[model samples]
Target chain A: MITHSNVWRFFTKPLMKTRLAPRRGLNGLAGKDIGDRQSRIIFTVLGFTALTALLLIVLFLFLEGTALFIHPAEDGSRVGLGDFILGSFWYPGYTPPEFGILPLMAASLSVTVLSACLSIPLGMGTALYLSSVAGPRVREWGKPVIELLAAMPSVVLGLVGMMVIAPFMQEWWDVPSGLNMLNASVMLALMAIPTIASIADDALESVPRDLLEASYALGATPLQTLMRTRLPCALSGVGAGIILGLTRAMGETMVVLMCAGGAAQLSFSPLDAVRPMTSTIAAEMGETAVGSSHYSALFAIGITLFLMTFAFNLLASFIAGRYSQKGYQAA
Target chain B: MVNDPNAVEVKTLNFFYGEKQALKNINLDIKRNEITALIGPSGCGKSTFLRLLNRMNDLIAGVRLEGKILLNGMDIYAPEAESADIRRRVGMVFQKPNPFPKSIFNNVAYGPMLHGIKNKHGLNRIVESSLRAAALWEEVKDDLHKSALSLSGGQQQRLCLARALAMEPEVLLMDEPTSALDPISTSKIEELVMDLKNSYTVIIVTHNMQQAARISDKTCFFYMGELIESGATDQIFTLPQQRQTENYITGRFG
Candidate 1:
């Protein structure tokens, strides 16, 4: 009849029935309880989907990377593990190609270390200014701009390094080639600054306000308070930020590939042109024949890069976890 | 100045948070070596008034102050007055215990070290004396290197007190120092405050009416950014002048 009471009963009747009947199989699917359970299952699957994909990719990398040890070179000689890792030269096209990645590893380490040197000071200073020194008006406008720097495409940065910075460095320093380790490092540092500064700013801001107040109440000046209380309290988080920045610098491909001159040699000077692991893989993988030893070697480089980043991520979380407990207790 | 009996003198002090006034036309005299308690309901500006003494309010943005605050007969807010020097002479303890995330010994030694007492023996003596003064030396003497964060809440609050005492300030300000503690800790701090009057002048802000009556010599009642009534604690509790003060004290209404 579509009366008012009939409509009201129609809405509440299912709920009332579900409450009384409790376990009517199939009918229970209509109840809110079943909907909640379904949504929970769906969310759990969605959460784990990325993790499953990661595991699959890691397994594939391991299989292909390990194939380099068993697969023979063009002349039918298999590369030993020690020789592949520690061999001084990486001329993969000579009579019996040398596949030692030491030069590549050396290039990777130098660029990352140099980038760290440049980025740490600039990043930490920016963080300090943003978190403590800047007024609210400055901070409100400044923070988003700094964060936006992180979103810039690595390829665009690489172009800038190759086109603009390369000529500048060659003219300024009078080096033979503008494309060198230092140029790559400088561009990498530029890439890493946003990551380091934003994370460090968050770390500094997260320091409990009471600690600063305590320091001030004890007659310490603002600089003294920052040095003694706030910095010490935020040390672990700041450390995590630095490590994350270094990891990004280490893993970066386009900037180093474009700026590092594609030379595969180990040299102590920052002026030397070099090819890091990622660039080596990126530059040579397209030319290598499928299922060949060079193909496996490139995959092997990928595995090394993956393991290094994984270890750094673990260390970052460990530092963040261990010291955060002490801060909680102090507060 | 030396003959002045009051540890602190306030005249027509008004405090504002941007356009909003937090403390209005406050006038009060805090006597030397006596406990003065500021009592009020939540958000009544007791804590704000306490923070003004050490210029801790300077840290906040959009805050303004008018009128004069004299600490030991010297104008604390004068253009030439260094806030660090004023803070050196006046120490503060907060509601929640906040110890530096360092060793217990380092926590107590922090203030002295800041003041440039660099010798090992000098630091050791001051840390020991301050800890003893705060009544925490006996429990923590053996474990001086232990992290201050590992201490119980009461011990942590006492460590904070010891940290402030290490600077040897002439006056100490406490903002509801025992509000976050258990009953036993509250009584312990109450006893410590009584003993502290012999050595240092103290001004405290508290929400606990009974705590004020039990520990304070002089009591000032605050309401809606105004100092409603202030007098000897006994008189303020037993005999009432203002209706609002009487109602607040009797628990009829806040």
Candidate 2:
């Protein structure tokens, strides 16, 4: 009859029905419950798959590495785990096949330490400039360029270290060869700068504007405010970024392989050519017998690299957590 | 042109952000040793006006100002005048309590330390005096080494006040200092502001008309980008000369 109540009900009845029923899309194929369940299942599966993959890799490394200590080499010579790790020489292809990894470990540590010393200051300065000092126009262009630097292939960086940087460093320092600890460290620092700068910038950007205003109100110069307030507030984040960069420097393989001069010696000078653990593995893995002590020794070095990077990441996360807690309390 | 020496005097002031004008031509003289309150709705340029005295607006980009703000008969906006010097003479408290993420003692002593007061005993005395001035010494004396963020919101606001007072500024500017506080904290701050006028010239901006009336000797009402009315607090509240001021004070509209 088209009465007022009839028209009202007719208009609102479908809406009420739609509201009361399980939510549906335009196609009306799957209800909200079904969609939620499907998403939940998919997410759970994806998460477990990632976890399983990580666990499997760790398990494989542990199995393959421990085999070196359990069995003798192809030439029937055995080395204790302690001696293999702590002893300095690493003459693997020799008749007796000495598998000591101390030289490799030393080379890796020296490169990492040098790179960290160089990159931390430079990266943090870049981060501070990008976050606080730079104008909006500069930040808009500078940030993406730094990120693009991070996206550059590690292998390409290795090539540059081998070709461009090594020769220049050799000529500048008047060393015998360009491929040395200094050259590798410089390349690694370049590789690590973007990571440190970006993360530190994020931390600096997160500091509330009100605090800065308070500093200004208290008559602090911009430099004083940055030194006392901004830097202290972002210290934890900066520390985390440094740790992440150090971790990258420690675990990086291709650059060391290409430029760290494959001499497995324990020289302390930066100018000396040395072979890091990753380089030893990459240089010798193809020639060694499939099930030999050399193969297991390489896997052992891999485990050590994994453990080192894992420890640094843990430290980085701990610092990150402390900073976020400080943020929460301040909020 | 009043006979009394003005602590701060603004003449024909206009402020802009990019091309949009935030404050229109304004003229006011804040007397020495008195609390002058500016009250207005949000986005009414009251806070903007408050920040002009110490040149805090210099921190913001695209902010342009015309005319003069004078402190102690000196043009604060003069080409040779340094913002840091002006800010040291005039301190500010923000709407929200923003204590640095540091110990309460350090927060109060930050200004003194910045000004090269490095002696331990000197810093201690300044910290104690500043905390006492803000009326937070008794409550926080024992835990002065604790993080300033550990304090209650009201206590934190007072700490922020103490931080400003540590500079021993001649003029104190507060922008809605009690708006973020509870009723009791609000009243406490109101009382503190009243007491502060004896030693430091105080200028406050508040959205609460009652707060302005309770604490201020002179009340200024701002609407949009203009100063609508200003007079003795009692006269403005009781017999506002402007319709907008009456409507705002009467709760008819903001």
Candidate 3:
């Protein structure tokens, strides 16, 4: 005795019930139907705009940096690309200026390597303590304090390095000045620690609780459990954290510019005043005349910085991918 | 049933989690080298009492226990008794299959390694004998280096059993060891548990009444934080002394 209307009601009744809820809408339509399309369109447009802006910036850097090799200098002399790149001295303002970037590249590489060595151990230790050993009360107060340190202005850290650390080093080590390669490295390491520690803490916290319980049930002491089980499980995240800290240290400008003593020299000793690529560009960009060789060289230094950071990010992703795969298969 | 020398004796045991009481005065004597099954509904504190044998509940915050749990006539709750030592002597298998994310060989070797067994040949012997004891050696002997997680759920559970056995514990505490497996796997584990009783004392918590009746020499029924009754398995299953025990066995209520 079923009729056509009864068949329709059977199909539509559940839909109608869902639509009739006041939370949906008074008009018996789902809330998502109201303005959802408009918001979707707006967000898509905003995302596209941001991506296009980033692409344009990279394009502009390439265009400006290559202008040096493409045209003659203002003095009507063609600068040899090899000499300009491989020569060690940088004397842009002197007559018959030499524009080799080797010294700048060396300084930048040495500072970054030294800073990484200083930060990785300290940051990872702090992260382990926060994730495993700290009580809940200590974690509640400690995490925000570390994050706040990250948010502080880099310029303030630079000023502190220049004023306080520089003088201390001068007295402690009998160095000529506190503003040297070592000073810049210390400042950069300080800035990088928060980035590494916070990310590593998150990674350690996400390790499965069951693994820890199994270790304990097997009669492993707490220290043995932490060292053998939890640390290995969270290693991928720790690798990622180390890379992020390295990225921060490599590209930091204000700290190195203010504390690196502004001498573009290639030296083996960490106590010597040395200029990194970031500091070089920051120091000379304002004084270099437009459409000049010096300006183009600065842009070229920018290109080098971009490539190095890009390589670092690629390395980080590689490490993350390899370890995470192992983690997944094992877990 | 009570004539066998007691392997574990509990005297007026009471347990609490913060302000909530989880177990009442629980008194029982598990016989030496025999299988004792604890059967109850959900949240009946059967698993809590099982963990109390090895002090597994010590990891939880705000947990308090009163009375005595004696293992081999030694008071295990004595302040001088280390939890690590107790755990080594009384191994456990969780309700879920919890093989470590390691090779099958390494998973079995982990317990012995923690106790200072380092020679490669020694570890190999321990791993082989333990897996054989758990009846999983033939299936996994060729793939000892394979990851433990790659195994099926039932096999993984047996691997966990083998891992615990590697430590050569005096007693094995199983918490719903077969609940998460298929019927075939459950029967296999049941047989293995029966075989284990010849060498090690076995205490298990199970929700399956049939499993309790089939394998356990002694059965203890718990309800609402209390040990309602315990006796020979045949007597408890066929002729219950308590009305509540009869009601539960007859399916009147959980």
TM-score per candidate:
0.92, 0.92, 0.90
Model 3 misses residue A151 by how many Å? 1.1
lDDT per residue (tens digit) for residues A1-331 in model 1: 7999997775666557557665767755653564445555667999899899989999999999999998788889889989988998897778688899999999999999998999999999999999889989999988999999999999999999999989998999999899999999999999899999999999899888998999999889989998888888888889899999999999999999999998999888998899999999999998999888888889998998898889999999998888777553332
Interface RMSD of 3: 2.7
Instruction: Give the distance in Å from residue A304's predicted Cα in candidate 3 to where it truly belongs.
Output: 1.9
Candidate 2 structure quality by residue, lDDT tens digits, A1-331: 7999997775566557666776456655443454444555667999999999999999999999989989987877777988888988898778888888899999999999999888998899899999989999999999999989999888999999999988898889888899999889999999999999998898888878998889989999999888888888888888898898889888888999998887999999998999998888788889878778888989999998888789889988998787667643331
lDDT of each: 0.91, 0.89, 0.89
The parts of candidate 2 lying over 4 Å away from their true place are A1-35, A326-331, B1-4
DockQ of each: 0.55, 0.49, 0.40
Cα lDDT tens digits for candidate 2, B197-254 = 8999999999888888888899999999899999999999999999999999999987
Writing each residue's lDDT as its tens digit, candidate 3 over B1-254 gives 24549989999999999999999999999998889999888899999999899888998889999999989888899999999899999989998998877788889998999989999999999999999999999999999888888899999999999999999998899999999999999999999999999999999999999999999999999998899999999999999999999999988888
**Could you tell me the lDDT of residue A146 within candidate 3?**
91
CA shift at A107, candidate 2, in angstroms? 0.7
Using DockQ, rank the candidates from best to worst.
1, 2, 3
Candidate 1 docking quality: incorrect, acceptable, medium or high: medium
- Candidate 3 segments whose C-alpha is farther than 4 A from its true place: A1-37, A75-86, A328-331, B1-4
Q: What is the lDDT of residue A30 in candidate 3?
A: 36
